[model samples]
Target: MWYYTLNGQQAGPVSQAELAQMLNGSLPSDTLVWKEGMADWLPAQDVDAFRNIEATPPSQTNGSNPYAAPNSIVDENIKLSGTDEIPATPIPLDIGFCISKSWKTTIACFGAIFLTWFVYILITSIVGGVLSTIGTAIDGPVAVAPITEGMTQQAPFLPSHNQSINQQTGTGAIIAGILNNIFTMFLGLGLTLIGLNLLRGKDTNLGQLFGQSGTKLFRLIGASILYGLMVGLGLVFFIVPGIYLGMRFMFYQTVIVDKDLGVIDSLKYSSSLTRDNKWRLFFLFIINCFIVLAGALALIVGLIWALPVAWLTLLVAYLYLHDGERSLAA
Candidate 1:
């Protein structure tokens, strides 16, 4: 609650609560001031700022009703009332700030697999040499013995086209493919850990990102797999439920990092936090995501610059978020 007696006219005695109610946009705090040895007005903190503002006792009223204050009156609420005007804040392309960085951080974070798994890929090829591998996918048999006929379609899913799998020609390709799949399968944890490190304002080189990320790797992987299955289940209802769950647990990374929550706990905790704030958080993603798009439109070059800056900016919020924990622990 604040009061301003402007230019000795005793104009206010404005209440901060009333201002809070009236403010539809970002309200700068430095606008108010305190006066020394003066009740009416003096530049309490600075020369240009307004002064002698007093906090109206929360229980008191300044108006005739004795229950409500003067600025509590509807028309006087805004500096200009009854006007359809947007406040002077930015258009707030929310996602523009960080989505790319999240991806980049994850990419860098996951760079360790390429570093660590190359030798393993070579070893697997040598061990599996001349072995006939048969697998049932959409095709009846994706086998090493080559077949030219059209692949059989499977039940409960789409049909496979005629594609040959040959041990002789496709072996290298197949090994590379398998290794790629391994990287992708483990991607959930790698990305989240690296992204979380990025969120914590840490340098996410291949080693640290992978190492720190490994702390929550398996747990996040399981959570991601579960989230995937849940999404698949929920999407049968045209995605309403899936969307709800996504927003609800979207903060799981933060939970995992700051609170040291396990994957499942982070998911549950995020869902709880977003119970009421889902739409707002979801929209924040949509708005900030545009910056990512703009970067993509600029080609990979723009992405190189936009990605880190945007990620660091969002990390600022994450930093503030964990500050409470830091303070409490301190």
Candidate 2:
């Protein structure tokens, strides 16, 4: 039996032949592999079973591997990535399968995910604090007049001195909140993209989270806002329409982050990709909500595990939907 590690998790117990076939020209030379005869796990290239298979070079053309055996496990629809040595073959994934994979990936990459969110919160807090302080300085102190016992200060919105100060503070807080929300939205785009990578068994670091591609950040943000507005407007008409729109446009961010597409194009692509699977996606979303709620009920500690799992599950689903759409089109 052979076992392989992906995204820092052990993923198989297949025969040597299947493992070799699955991995030959499909993974990097340095990817870890192990079997019963081995003392410990080693890189695929170092193992005798895989010595005959050469690692696919980065410069290889965007076509099927010539060296692959007749019954190689590589899928015909697999597309070559210029950045990755081995092409990633997207397979149609079921909700249950993705949920399981998402949980595993989340657990494996917990430290990185937690640190990324922590840094985001910390920076936003600092900015909000600075804004609050500046707002306070500008507003100056509020003067409170001495009142006899039982005399009620009934001026709620009459522009009293205290009311003025409170209003200014409220305005400042609102401004700071808006700024924080904007920053979080952009930061979250990058984090979401990092989570997407985790679904493919890639280990992501904090540096990558911050420096992640911003080539389509604004477009992503725009698409997100547009989707939200569409959903909101649909809800105004009725509940079912909103749910429908939500499911349909759910993958807008995924398309934007993965394809670096324009705002409108990402929305259209997401709509098309989700056309036949809206009900499945809707149920998936409901299940995930329950999963996260269950995690939150576990003294709030479970959210640390649950939230990442939910995010990764959606990414995995997006990958499948993306592949499914391509196949249908072809």
- Best candidate according to lDDT: 2
Could you give candidate 2's per-residue lDDT for residues 1-330 as a string of tens digits?
456665555665554555666666565666677644456777777887777776643232333322211222432222122111111322334788668777776677788878877777787778778876776665665555555466456753344666656756676566766666766667777777777766665667766556645667678678878998999998998688999999988887777667766787777666655666788888889889998999999999998888878877788777656443221111
- Model 2 alpha-carbon drift over 4 Å, by segment: 1-93, 132-171, 212-215, 324-330
- TM per prediction: 0.43, 0.62
TM-score of 1: 0.43
**Candidate 2 — which pairs collide?**
none
Error of 2 at 250 (Å): 1.5
Which consecutive 10 residues in model 1 have the weakest lDDT in total?
81-90
> C-alpha displacement of 213 in model 2, angstroms?
5.2
